[model samples]
Each structure stands twice: as structure tokens, then as C-alpha cells.
Target: MPREISLCDIKGLVGSELGVSAWFTVDQSMVDSFADATNDHQFIHVDPERAAAETSYGGTIAHGFLTLSLLSAMNFDCLPRVREQQMGINYGFEKVRFMTPVKTGSRVRGRFTMAEARFRGPSMVMTTYAVTVEIENERKPALTARWMTLIQFDPKDRPSET
Candidate 1:
């Protein structure tokens, strides 16, 4: 069974390995959809024939941002939730780098590590996760990023001042 953890539990678990999701495939269709959505119809992303003929990657590659966006799905699958918090927001990314190409029709998985956890009054500022999405069968990672999320807990729900 998977672990069920709350928001407070995460705060106490700073500098620990959070979780990692099972591998997911990046198919050509998905890559094409991302390219259409972003208007980035570069041959490397959408044109399979052109990509095969020209790029050293030897096939269509996924967009870097597309791989970055997978962090959310990976987080949902791997990270334990904060039941008390009504919602969590994607504050921003501290840093992001494309370490290697994610070729279409390849599988990738993300590994998350809890970097820092701090409280800002009622809000929990989590400087979490150097997320590394590794391409299956490839030593080089497809993407890496430092992502942050803010979880807000209601003051009224807290233990009374005593």
C-alpha cells in the first residue's frame, strides 16, 4: 500500500526523498498535441520525417516545456497530499534545465526530493523537488527542475492559542 501523508507531515520531512512515479510513455500523438497547443511546430517536435532526416536524435522529440509540464502529473502520482489544505498552487519554478532529449515513443519517470520546507504564517512554502525525469534506457535525464508549491492552511482550523 502507498503511504498517506498530510501537510504537516511533509514539513517535518524536510531533506528527505519524497517519491517517484511509474514510467509514462511520450507518444508521437502526445508530442504533436503539445506542439499544436503551443504553436511550436518545429520539425523536432512535430515533423517526424524531417526530424528523422536531420536531427541527431533520429526521431521526433518532445518539447522541453511538454516534459516540464509532466511534473504536475508525476507529482500527483508520487507526492502524498496535504488533507488539511484546501488547495495548493504552483507558485513558480526556481530553476529548470533540459538535460537531454525525450524522443517520442519513449518512457520517462520522475524522481522527487524534498529540498526545503518553511512556514510563512498560514501558508506553507515548500521548496521541493529537484525533479528528474529520466528517459527509459537512457542515462541522461529528459528534464530537470526545481519546483515550488504553496499550501495554505486555514488559521481557524489550527489548534487554539493556549
Candidate 2:
């Protein structure tokens, strides 16, 4: 688990590794739910029998976006709260690649490293994470993303808001 960190702590370690999230499993239920939400009922993602017979993956697999969505929960698990900041926004992503299939029943976790952090006046623009979602027992990663976040804070407290 990552230690609880304030905005100040992040500033001090601007170009350093920050944290990693605990492992989370991708099961059939999750896949089914994602399929329902996205209306992507591709056999490889939702139909186990057809996938087993037709696809190289051997069974139902998770949708790529489903795997990407894991970032939200994963980040929450890994990143400590910025007490002084009112909120943080999902600024954008620099790069995102899905390297391998995430088969149903496999476990995945994210490892985050801070790439860069810059103060944009009252707000901090942080290109902070190179998140790799690794599959348990698999050689390749399920997804890799360079994610950015904007942390907004009060200027009056800048000195104390590291």
C-alpha cells in the first residue's frame, strides 16, 4: 500500500517513482458486465464456448477498455490523498497501448512511476504515471499507459502545499 501523501510530498519527488496498486482479478462476471455496458458482445470477449473453439485466446477475454477502466480503481488503491487540493482531474494520457489479451480469470495489477510533475500556477500538471497492468503468471502486460493528472490547489498555501 502507498503511504498517505500530501501535495508537498509529490512536489519533493517530482521525477520519482510513486506507488503501485494491489492486484485485482478479471472474472467472467466483470467481462459480462463490461459487455453489457459497452454493447460489445464480441465472441472473444463474451462467449466462452465460441471463444474456446474459435479464438487463439482459448476462452472469454476482457474488453480492452474494460482493462483500461481498471486504472480508476487501481489509482485509488495506490495514490495517497492530497489533503490541501480541492480535487484532481484526469488531464489526459500521453500514450496507451494494449500489449496482450487479458483472459478471464486472470489477475492484474498496476505499477505506477512518476515521470514528471510541473506546477502550472494555481494548478499542478503532473505527467506522473507510467502504469503497467501486468497479468499474473503471464510474460506480457495487459496494458501500459502514460497517464496525466492535474492537481488544483490554493496559491496562498503554495509554500505548505508540497
**Highest lDDT, which number?**
2
Local accuracy by lDDT, each model: 0.81, 0.83
Note the clash tally of each candidate: 0, 2
List ranges where model 2 is wrong by over 4 Å: 160-162
lDDT per residue as tens, model 1, 13-132: 777778888898999999989988999998888888889999898889999999999988988888877767777889899999999989999999999988877666654545566778
Error of 2 at 90 (Å): 0.8
lDDT of 2 by residue, 57-115 (tens): 88998999999999999988887777767778998889999999999999999888887
> Which stretches of model 1 miss by more than 4 angstroms?
157-162
